[model samples]
Every structure is written in C-alpha cells, then in structure tokens.
Target: MELGVFLFRPLIRNRADFKQAEETLKKSEVWIRNIFKSLKEAVFVITPDRIFLDMNEAAQEMFGYTKEELVNRPSAIVHIDHEQYLEFGKKMEEVINKGEITNFQFKMRRKNGEIFPSEHTASLMVDNEGKPIGIVSVVRDLSEQKKIEEEKEKLQAQLQQAHKMEAIATLAGGIAHEFNNALTGVVGNIELLEMRLPDNKIVTEHTEAMKSSSHRMANLTSQLLAYARGGSYQAKTISLSDFVEETLPVIIPNIGPSIRIDTDLPRDIFKVNVDSAQMQMVLSAVVSNSSEALGGDGRIRVITSNEEIDAEFAKSQPGLRPGRYVCLTVEDDGEGMDEETVNKIFDPFYTTKFMGRGLGMAAAYGIIRNHGGWISVDSEQYKGTVVRIYLPAIEAEKKVKKEIITEPKLDIAEGEGTVLIIEDEEMVMNVTRAVLVRLGYHILEAKTGKEAIEIAKTFDGQIDLALLDIKLPDIQGDKVYPLIMKARPNLKVIVCSGYSIDTAQG
Candidate 1:
C-alpha cells in the first residue's frame, strides 16, 4: 500500500509540473507576439518552400496585404518579379548552407504594383532539433533613404559648382579691369591721332578702323565685367513690366519669326532697382537661349508675377534670401537638355551649340546676382525647359519714370586749365597727359596716390582739376580723395575707374 501511494504521488507531481511549464510557454509566446507586432521594420515568416507563413503588422502595411491574405501564399507576390524571386531564393539557400544571414538590397513590389527599393535581412528559422523550418526576414524600405542620399549628393555638387564659379568670376573681373586700363590708352591715343591728322583722309580711315576695333573690344570687356558682377553702371528703380514691354520690340527681330513669343507682363508687378541696359541684356539673353533651344516653330511664354520667398524655401537655395520678389518665368516648348548639360549651363564658356560664345547665360547669371536676384533652371530630355529669375521687389510707390536724354556729340574744344592726372598704368597716364596737353591744359602727372597727394600739397601752380584713378598701389582713390581734399579744398575732383561707378564708389 505504501509503494502504490508513492507512485501516485510522483504522477501527481509530474502533472503539476507539466501544467506550470505550459503556462510559462503561453506567457512567453504572448510576450514574443507583442514584441513582433510592435516592431517598426517589416518582419515576415516564410515556410522552407518559400510560402508565407505569418507576418507582423508592419509587414502587412509594407506589402499592402493582411496576414490572412498572405499566409499560405507564395512569397513571390512581394518580389519585383519571378526571376528576382528565384535569384533571391538561391542566394538565401547559399547563405543558409554556410550558417550565415542574408542581407542585400532588392527591388520589391507593393500591392498596388509599384516597384520600389527595399533592404532585406533574412535568416533561417530552425526547430528544436536544429532542422530548418522557415525563413525570418526583416525588410526596410529604402526609397526614402535613397532620395535623401541623392539630395545630399546634389547639394554637394551645387556647392562645388558655386565655388568654381566664384573663382572664375574673380579671374574675369581682374582681367576685365586690366583690359579696360589698357584700352583707355589705345582709345585716347587714337583720339589724339585723329585730332592731329584731321585733314589726312588716309590717316582718318586707318584711325577710324582702329577706333572701331577698340570700340568692339571695349564692348567685349563690358560683357566680361557683367559676368564678373561689376557691370551695373546706372541702377534706377523702374517698372519691370514696362521695361520688358519696351525692350521686347528690339529683341523680337533678332529671334526668327518661327519662334512665337507670348508675353504676360502684368502692369501690377512690383518694381525693381536694376541697371536698365543690363536688365535688357538679361532678358535678351534668356529669350535667345530659349529661341536656340527651339530649332524652329515653338512657343515661348514670358510671364512676370510677384512672389514671396519664405524662409524654409530660401534656406534650401544658396545665396538666396527671404523677401518679396518679382519673378520672371520663361517657358519654352523645345528640345530640352539632360541633367549633365543643365548643370553646366551657367558655367562660362560651356555651350552645346556648334558655334557659340557661351558667355550669354553666364553673363545673365551674373547680372541677376549682382542685382540681388536669383536664377533657376529646370529641364528634362525631350520634354522642355523653364527658367525663373527672381529679383527683389520694391513698393510700387517707389517706382520712377526714367527720362531719355539725348546728348549731341561735341568736338574736343581746347581748354585752358591746370589738370592733375593720377594713374598707375604708365601707358594710360602718358596718353591721358598727351590728350590733356593737346586740349591746352597744363598736365601734372603722378603714378601713385602718394605722389598725387604731395603734388596737391606743394605744387606752386594753381591745380584746376584732379583726375583720380580709383585703384592705386599706395592708397585707394576713395581714401586719397579725402586726404587730398584737406590740402586742396577748392579743387574739382573727377573719379575714374575700370569698374562701374556704383562698384567703384562702394
């Protein structure tokens, strides 16, 4: 009787232990299920035969399917294609054989049939005996990540381009300044020669030819200065819409008749302070670029509107500020450029045409930038192109009508005065002295600002006018002006510079 009771006791103890073990297993399974559902990454369980066994909430959301719909179904439905599925399966099998996990990027399909990039991490699940049962995979959608990476790369490229353009602009400005100084000598000498040999027809012809060539070179230098952001000579606040309307007549003849132009210049547009001639050049260049894009027979729309740039939008674009802006949009239905070509369009000397100066768009870019404006371009292959130029706007009440004044050309009448010429370049100084001396003015020359200041202080003769070069080796012309004024308070001063008057003053 004691042995039988002990056997029953052992059976009762075993039953109690089994019940406790079953409850613990149930709790663990619930905990694991809760963790799986709470996961952000899509988790999936697949049978060894590549059939979907179960999936978490994230997985169902990611693939646009419910667990009940995908369970017991082939996993190929989520893959980009059957061939990709097979390849992925082979790779998974190879990794499992090596007792490793599979991780890779693969294109995946959503329920709506949209294909997208996805990162997949998969491993084999095993039973208690260590035999493979199914696959456990965690997938991450890489679409947003790829987009962010692409945006970062684009910003980096834009920064590099801005640096390159800045360097180029410095070089161009220096060259233009030096070239203008040299041209001053040439043009002055030619004028003196013309004055001396007025009666000689042959000499007049040669001198005129030289003058024409020099004038053309001067124009080229002006364009270079424009591209260097030193070209706005006379900036005035005016109605941009009116200015465009007046300038389009002159520009239309240049663009062939096949290219139709439509303008929507609303009179209510905000006014902008810009150099009229430079703005005209910008408009002409932008129109010409669009015209060239259209081999022939395409519509071009020029529209102007008031726009307000917000801080967030301004922050995304370099060198842009938040403000009320007047936007000029030029849209063209023509052969467009690819991304690579569009990137280089604003670079100096970059062009797609067989014959082009390539400075048109570059100068346009500089002119707008110099006027406190920004330019942007959008294009697609075979689709079209759109360009937007934004200039800071002023209140309409500040708009002023600029009057046109025509000045008749006057002959160089001889003058009697004592003139002081302060110039650094030897050729420019010599030619200027000769021209003044020829005009019956006594010349006092100084190659440096110090020399000029000394001449103003100690010179016994009455100094009538002082011609001061803005740029000097010893002291800048602006600084020298105040110092020399201390000595010669009554002397009249004329400021000269290779740069525009506005830039020179600043």
Candidate 2:
C-alpha cells in the first residue's frame, strides 16, 4: 500500500507541472497576439508563397480591406502593380538570406485603386529548424512625411531667396545713391555749359547728345533705385481698379497689336497706399513680361480682386503678414516657364529673353515689398503663368483726395537770396555752386555737417536757404538741420537725398 501511494504522488506532481506549462504557453500567445493587434503601424503576416496569412486592424485600414477579405489572398493586391509585386518578391529572397529586410520603400495601392508611397520593414518568420516559413512586415505610410519634407525644403528656399534679395537691395541702393550723385554733377554741369556756350550748331548737337546719353543713364539708375526700394517719391491712397483702367491704354500700345488685352477691374475693389508712378511701373513690368511671353498672339488677362490672408496662409509665404489685401492678377496663356526658370525670375539680371536687362520683375518685387505687399508667381512648362500682386488694403470709408495738377514753368527761376550748400561730394558741390552762382544767388559752401553748422553760426550775411544733403561726412543731415535752424532761426531749409522720403526719415 505504501509503495503504491509514493508512485501516485510522483504522477500527480508530473501532471501539475504539465498543467502549469500549458497555462504559461497560453499567456504568451495572448500577449503576442495583443501586441500584434495593438500596434499603430500596419502589420502583416504572410506565407512563404506571399499569401496573406493574417493582418492587424491597422493593416486592414491601411489597405482599405477587411482581415477576412485579405486572408489567403495574394499580397500582390496591396502592391502598386504586378511588376512592383514581382520586384518585391525578388527582394524577399534577400530577406530570407539575410534574416530580415529593413526600410524598403515602395509605392502601394489601396482597395479603392489609390496609389501612395509607403515604407515597410519585414522580417523572415522561421520554423523550429530555422527554415523560412513566412514573412511578418510592419508598414508606414510615407505620403505625409514626404509632404512635410517638401514643405520644409520649400520654406528653406524661400528664406534663402529673401536673404539674397535683401543683400542685392542693399548693394543696389548703395550703387544708385553714388550713381545719382555723379549724375547730378553731370546734369548740372551740362546745364551750366549750355548757358555759357555761344550758339554753335556743332557744339549744341554734341551737348544735346551728351544730355540724351546722360538721361538714359539716369533712367537706368532710376530702375536700380526702384529695385532698391528707394524710388517711392509720393504715396497716395487710390482705388486700384480706377488706376488700372487709366493706365491700361498707355500699356496697350507697348504690348503690340498682335496680342489681345482683357481686363476685369471691378468697381468695388479695395484701395491701396502706393506711389502712383511706381505702381504704374509694376503694372507695366508685369504686363510687358506677359506680352513677351506671348511672343506674338495670345490673351493676357488683368484682373483685380480683394483677398484676405489668414495666419496659416501667411505662414507659407515668407515676409507676408496676415491682413486684408488687394490682389492684382496678371495671367497669360503663352509659353510658360519651367520650375527652375520661375525660381530665378525675380532675381536681378536674370532673364529668358535676348538682350533683356531682367530688372523689371526684380524692381517690381522690390516695389511691392516696399509697399508692405508681396508677389506670387505660378507657372508650368507649356501651360501658362499667373502672377499675383498683393497690396495692403485700406478702409473703404477713408476718403482719398484727388491730387491737384499744375503745368510746369519750363524755366529755372533765377534766385536772389543767399544759399547755403552743404554737400560732401566735390563734383556735386562744384556743379551746384556753378548753377546757383549763374542763377544770381550768393553761395556759401560746406563739405561737412560741422562746417555747415560753423558757417551758419559765424556767417555775417543772411543765409536765406540751406540745401542740406541727407548724407553727410560727420553728422546726418537731419541732425544738422535742427542745429543750423537754431543758429539761423529765420532760414528756410530743404532736405535732399537719393533715398526715399521714408528711408531718409528713418
């Protein structure tokens, strides 16, 4: 009886151990199944022949199919095409040999026939003997990631372009300033020479030629100054639609008779504060660009509309702020530009046309930016190009007064008062002195701000007018103005500079 009891005890202990092992195995299976289903990324289990064995909820949602529908079906149904499936099969052989494949990017198709970019990391599932039995893969959709990367690159490009344009504007402003000073001397000297020279046809012809050449050079400098944002002489709040209507006739002849011009200037369009001349130049540049793009016969549409830029929209466009704006759209149905060409269109000296100076668009860009606006261009090869200029809109109720016009006298008035000329440039000073002396005004000269103040203090004669150059050697002209005013309380003053009034004040 005792021997039988001991044997039974050993049997019972063995049965208990076997039961415990079975329960542990069940727990592990549940754990693994839960992990597979709970994964955020799409997971797939396939047979050696690439038949779908099992899939998680994420996989079903990713492929737009139910688990029961995809099970036992060929995995090729989820691939972009049959050829891509075959290519994937070839890659599976490498996976089998290497024990796994990681980060294999490819295009995938959904049940509704939509193809999107995807990346999958697959591992070889093995049997007890380590023989490849199937594949288990985790997949991630790359469409959003790719989109984010593209946006980042685009923003980087825009930032780079802004920096480049800023540098160019600084250089251009400096050049225009110096060039305008030199031109002042040339133009002033020419005026002096014309007055002094006796009547001779040959001399008159040569001087006129020089004057014409100088004027052309001055025009070129003006364009550079426009590109540098220093060309805005006067700003007025005006209806954009009315301005466009008034200017289109002048632009039409230059566009040529071959091309047709269409305009949709709505009466209720918003008003903007801008220099009329500079705004006209912007329109001309844009229209001329479209005309040149047409190359002979095509339609150019000029349209005006009100736009509201929200914060999200403004975030995508560099240097743009969210606000109400008036949009001027110029669209052309002609030979368009490629992505590369469009990217460089606003760069100074960049052009597609033969012998083109390429300053028009660049100057237009600067003008709009200086007016607290922006320009956007969209183009595709052989399709069409659309340029949108956005200017800040003012309240509709604000009254815009019409500018008064008067005819010019056409003659330089002879001056009788004593003039104080404060200039740093020698050529400018000499020509200016010659002009004032010729005009019958007694002149007092000073090359620096300190010298000008000293002359204002000690000069015995009454200094009636002080022509102050904004840029001076020692102190700024604005600073010197108050000091000289303190010294000569009754003196009148005029501020002169190549920069815009806003810039000079700044």
Candidate 3:
C-alpha cells in the first residue's frame, strides 16, 4: 500500500510540472508576437500558396491597406511586375529550402497603385514538430536610401567637373601669359614703325592693318585672361538701361539687317555696380551668339527686369546668393542648341559654330562670376536661345561723374629720364627700350629680377622709373620690387603684367 501511494504521488507531481511548462511557453509566444508587432519594419506571414495569413501594423501601413483588406489576399497584390511576382515565388521556395534568404530587393506596389523600391528578408515559419507553417518576411523601404545614393553620385560628379574647370583655368593662365608677352612686342614695334614711316596712304593703310591685327591679338589675350579668372577691371555704379541705349549704335550694325532688334526695359532703369567694359563684353557676346543662332533671319530682344531671389531659389545654383538683382536677358529667335551643346556652352574652347573662337560665352561667364554675378543659358533645339545675366542691384545713390584724367601728352623731344626696364622676353625688352630711347630717355635693361637688383645697386646716375614685369625666372616681380625699392628709395615703380592682376596676386 505504501509503494502504490509513492508511485501515485510521483505521477501527480509530473503532470502539474508539465501544465506549468505549457503555460510559460504560451506566455512566451504572446510576448514574441507583441515584439513582432512593435517592429518598425513591415512583417508579413505569407502562406506557401502566396496568400497573406497575418501582418504587422507596418506591413498594413506600407501597403496602404488595413488589416481587414490584406488578410487572406494573394501576395501578388504588392508586386507591380508580373515577372517580379514569379521571382518572389521562387525566392520563397529558396527561403523554405535553405532556411532563410536576406536582402532580396524588389519593387512593391501600394493599394493606391504607387510603387516604391523595397528590400526584404524571408525565413520559413514552422511548428514545434518542424512542419512548415508559412513564410515570415521583414521588408524595408529603400526609397530614401536610393535617393541618398543618387544625390551622392550627383555631388561627386559636380566635384569632378569643378576639378576639370580648375585644370582648364591653369592652362588658360599660362597661355595668356605667353600670348600677352608676344603681343607687347608686336604692338610696340608696330607703333614705332608707324612713327618712322612717311604719311603715304599705302604706307599708313598697311601699318593700320598691322595695328588692327595687334589690337585683335590683345583682345584675344584679354578673353583668355578672363577665362582664367585673371582679367582686371574696375567696377562702378551704372544704369543698365542707359548702358544698353548707349551701346545700341555699336551693336546694331554688327547684327545684320535681316535680324530685327527689340528692347523691353523698365521706365526706371535697373542700377547695378559692375565693370562697364566687362559688362559690354557680356552684352556683345550674348548678342553675337544670338546673331549666329538667328543666321540673319530672326529677331533679337534685349530685356531688363528687377528680381529678388530668396535662399530657397539660390540653393539650386552653386555659387549664387540671395539678394535683389538686375536681371538682364538677351533672347533670339534663331537656330538654338540641343541639351548637349547647352551643357558645354560655358566651357572654354567649346563651340558649336564652325568659325567660332569658343571663348565668347566662357569669357562672359568668368567676367560675371568675377563681378559676383551669375550667368544662365537656356536653349531648345531648332527653337531659340536665351542668355540671362543677373547682377546685384544697389540703392539709389548720388551719381558721381567718373572723372577722366588723362596724362599730359609729352613730346618725344621733351621727354628726359633714365629708365630701368626689367623684362625676360628679348623682343619685348628691345622694343620697350627703343620706345624709351625714342622718347629721349636713357635705358638700363635687365633680363631677370636678380640682374635688375644688381644693376640698380651699381648704377651711379639717377633712376627716374623702373618698368618691372610681374613674371620673372628668378622670382616674382612683386617680391623683387621691395629689394629694388631699398636700393633706389626715390625711384617711381611701374609694375606690369600681360595678364590681369587679381588682388591676391597683386
């Protein structure tokens, strides 16, 4: 009887323990379900037949469907492409056979027919006995991620473009330097030749041609300097409407008779502080480009308007600022450019026309940028082109008359001085010396900065002025100037360069 009682008590204890264990397991399952529901990622439980069994709140929100609409629905509802749907089925089979598959990317459709990129992971759901129940998938929206990636790529491309422009600017600077040195010799010699030649019509005509050619070369060098961001100019307050009016006589004849010219300016002209010469260059480049676009058949319109750009608008432009601007626009009804051509219009040496120098628009762009302004080009293939220039506006202030103070013209016989010429180029040095000699000044020459200092120190006579070239093989001309100054304290110094002297370089 005692043995039977002991066996019955042991059986009772085992049954009670099993019941507690079963209750704990049910609580754990409830907790796990709550955890799945709380997840930010969409969790979907799909049957082997691709029917939706259950889903979390995220899954409902992601598909734009409520729990009632999604349950028992075919998983094909979220797949926009039919082939993608078939691919999903194969992936499900893979997950079931291989235990799990992760980071499967696909396009998903919402209930509203909106589609978005998504990435998801799937694993086989099973019962305690290891029998397959359904497939559990955790899906993540990749739309924002893809957008970030695309933006990153665009920024990288812009950086590469900036680097390329920098390289081009360096090359342009070197070319301008060399070209300017050559022009100095050509122009100086031509002027000397003109002074010596007799006043015959034929002789004067040929010399004038030489002068014209030299002037054109000078203009070309100036444009290259502009492209290199080394072109120098003085900015002053100017009225845009007045400037255009004054420039019309110069511009009209060059545009040809077939192309009609029109103007639309405000009664009160927009005022901007800018370099008049550079501004003129900008206008000329735009009009010339328009004339070519028209092929001597269409109309060119010059329009001016006031504008105020906000930060939001300026954000799209890389170097633009938020402020009031005088918007000067030049539009033409000519053969316009395609997108590819328009994209490269501002690049130096890039041209669409057969006879173009390719520096017009590039110089215009650089000049505007140097003046703290922006230039935009818009064109449509076979339609037309519109070039817009935005310059900062200034408040109404006293119009100061720019005083034109000219140097007193000195006769070659009256001129008297001992001038020092420091230059590296032999032709430029010789021509410069001849000009001074003709002006009745004694010349002291040096081919380099070191040689110039040595000559200045040893010279016993009065050194009236020093014409120093900015570029030297031994040292920068600015650095050498102080040494020369120390040697000759009372001497006047004229620093010269073939290129523009920017403030930093000056």
Candidate 4:
C-alpha cells in the first residue's frame, strides 16, 4: 500500500528502487541541516505533545540547552513562564490551517529568563496528500532599533534651543534703539520744565504734571520693550493669585474686545521664583496670539497647577529636567495651527503671516528659554491651542532690607570750565547744552566727531568733560574714544548714547 515513503523500509519495487529511495531521503535531511546551521535567530519546533522535536544552532545557544537535553525533553529551561507559552500553540493551529503565515511582533524569553521584543513567522508542513503536520518558525530580535530613535529626538531639542537664543539677540537690539530714543525726548522735556518755572508756582505745577504723564508713557513703553528683549526678569517670591490679578489688566487690553477672557488662578499663597515681567510676557503673547486666531470673537481660559516631576517622569518629557515646577497653561477656543506651522513656530523670522505681521511669538520663545523654563503647545486646526509654560519655583521668605543706599546730589558749580558736547544730532546736542547751562557749566557743542575736535581747540577755558556720542556721523564709538583721549589726554569723558553698551558695539 505504501508509495514512495515508509518510515524504516524502502518502496516495494526492486533492490535498486530501495537504494534510490534511501539516497533521496538522505539528501533531503542534509539540505535541512545545512539551512539551520547558518541561521542567526532562534529556530526550532514543538510537537503537539509539547516535546522538544528539533532546534537549530541559534535555538540551542538561546536556551543554553544541549542537543541531548532538547532532543527529548520539553523546552522549559529557556521559558520560565511555561504556562504562557501555550499562546504559541494557538498561533501554530492558525498557521497549520492557513499553510503559511506572515511575521508577527511579540516578546520572548532568553536563557536567563529575560523577556525581550522579538518577531516570528511560521509555515505548516504537510504530507503529499496535503494533511497538516507541524509548524516551522523563523525568529528575529529588536532592541537596537529603539535606541536610535531616542538619540534622534534629543538632537532635535538642542537645535530648537539654539534658534531661541538667536531670536532674542535680534529683538533686543531693535527695542533698545527705538525705546531709548523716545525716552530721550521724555527726559529732555522734564529738564526744560525745571528751568522755566520756580517750584510751587502755577506754571511750575503744570510743567510737573506734564512731566509725570511723560514718565508714565516711558514706563509703559519700557514694559513692552522688555517683552521683546527676553528673560530680563526680577525674580522674587510672590502670591500666584496676586500675580494673575495684576497681569490680567495689562494682558486684557492687548487682546481684542471681541474675546472674553476667563481666569481660575487660586487665591492660595502659592509662591514661586518667577520674574513677574517675564511671566507677564509669556501670558500676553500666548493670549494675544490666541485672540488673533479667533478673529476677535472667542474665550480664553488660564489655569495654574503645582506639579512635581520625578527623574523617570521628566526623562519622558522633551528637554525637561527632574524637579518642582509651577505649570501655567493658556487655552483658547480659536482657529488653531497645523502640523507644519506648529513645528516651525519657535524658529526666528518663521511666521504664519503672509508678508509682515512682525515677530509675534519669536520673542516669546526666547523669554521662556532664558528663564531656564520649558514651553510646549498642543493645537488642532479649527479647534484650539493650549500653551503650557513650566517655571521653576522656590520657597518664599519674609522680605527684609539689609541696608539703605543714598547717593548725594552734587551741588552745581557755576564754573567758566568748557564742556564739549559731541553728539551726532543737532537736536540732542542743543538739548545737552541747555541742560549743562542750567547747571552753570559753559558748553562747546559739536554735531559731528570732526567738528568736536575743532571746538576743543578753540575752547575759551579748560575742557572739563567730553559728553561723547558713542555713535557719530564721521567715526564709531571705539574709534572716537581713542582720538578724543589722544587730543585731551586728561579730559573727564562721560559716554552718553541711546544704544545700550551691547548695541553700541553691534
């Protein structure tokens, strides 16, 4: 009844037929053995009886079991949780019915009872009549792939930090230039008012009132400039509720009239080491940006919470360290951002505006980063955007003044001493001379650096001080300083310019 196969005996034909059948069976065994020898992943099989049937070199290495132990014993030394291994039986049954299967991801146990990620694929073997027999699996291991992905994300965070620093540098220069020029006008008017009228008179009283208004305008402009400057914060302990209440008035006006702002800041005495101005900048930009999104008709909600992040938890967050932080979140119901816009939002000069809406949140990115803080945004198009700012906190202590500082005002001397006021603009130079004359100091004014040297030579008396403009019509600050020093070697020089020291060099 047997055709080409009978376990121990050959086919019933002749002696040559018997020998040929034996040779064919021997060749097949050699082919399977050679294939298993070179495999890198664990390869083996289990019978329906749960006995160790056959295993390749990888399977033997993985299990730490010899061929003798595996050929007859159950594959239990590698898999400690032997009961859970029954799931493989269900997979095998499916493969047997299907004849072939695709690879699947799963966890597997090593010789040391360690479970790791792996994948396996199986095929059903059959007799010539196509009756199902057993399964053959090809296994693969996956630990190195996950490590590469983590490194890539860390590099991206560092790139984002560098971009934030560059944006602050650009914004600060522009703010200082414009705001200080405006302040010069303010202080110039106040100085003029003092000379024209005596104290306590009606004329002097009105002049003083105008001066107060100008100073208020100066203060408001300074606050907005600081928002553009980034990270210049006076950090101290303050009540969270009070901070919000104080910030709301300034921020609300920046938002649109159509937007209804809501707040839920706690009245409890929760204190943190935050720069009030820097925090205000963060709140203003985020809320204003949201209002801009809503087309002037929406609501914004601001909430604060105390959160502690352990080392394990912090590692999961992008660019965050393990510590205590006060989380302030701004939520707005508006037309939110898409994936492309959100990714590039923090980049300098990269804006959603068509031509020039200006640096809307470019400065906001710098302010938070400068505070050693973290900011993240979640947004969906036509839905909303939630911006979260995490700031480090410290314990608040009772305030105390250690000492008092009082610098005495020097009494003005009516001297015949010559003062050379070297400034680029005629308006600024004329104002400087007027202020000095009020103090009874005779003045020699020059509109350019070249003219300044000529005035010093023709001075009627000794040149006392040179109020040199760091920026000049003919020469730069550094160049002018040396020329003036060489000419009037011992002259007392007071460097006065609208630009900050950093900007003067720039």
lDDT score for residue 124 of model 3? 80
Counting clashing residue pairs in each candidate, in order, gives 0, 0, 0, 0
Model 1 ranges with Cα > 4 A deviation: 1-24, 396-413, 501-506
RMSD of each: 6.5, 6.8, 8.1, 11.7
TM-score of each: 0.88, 0.87, 0.74, 0.50
For residues 1-506, what per-residue lDDT tens digits would candidate 4 score against the true structure? 11113112334488888688778866765665676677887876655444566778887776566667777566455453666466666676678667777467667777567776667777655555666544567777665665666666755664664555455555664665566666676577667776766564877777778878877765544443443442134566676667878888987877679889888787653466656766776677777788887877989998887767688756655556777677778898888989777776665456675212544465566556555567777898888899887766553213211111122333345666677788876667667778778878878777787787766656566787777776787877557766777767777666556543221110
Which numbered prediction scores highest in lDDT against the true structure?
2
Which has the higher lDDT value, candidate number 2 or candidate number 3? Answer: 2
Mind giving the per-residue lDDT tens digits that candidate 1 earns over 1-506?
11112112222257779787656656666677787889999998877678887789999999899989898898899888889999888867865686578898899999999888999888876654566767788999999999989888877887787788778888988898899998998999899998898899999999989999999998888888888886535677787888888988999998879989998999888888888989898999889888888876788999999999999778666777888889999999888989988888887788786216657888888888787788999999788899999988966224322321223333336888898888999988899899988889998988899999999999997898888888899999878888888898888777776764321111
Q: Best candidate, TM-score-wise?
A: 1
User: Alpha-carbon error at 39 in model 3, in Å?
Assistant: 1.2
lDDT of 3: 0.79
| Pick by TM-score: 3 or 4, better one | 3
Which residue pairs collide, candidate 3? none
How many residue pairs in model 4 have overlapping backbones?
A: 0
lDDT of 3 by residue, 464-484 (tens): 888888888898887988899
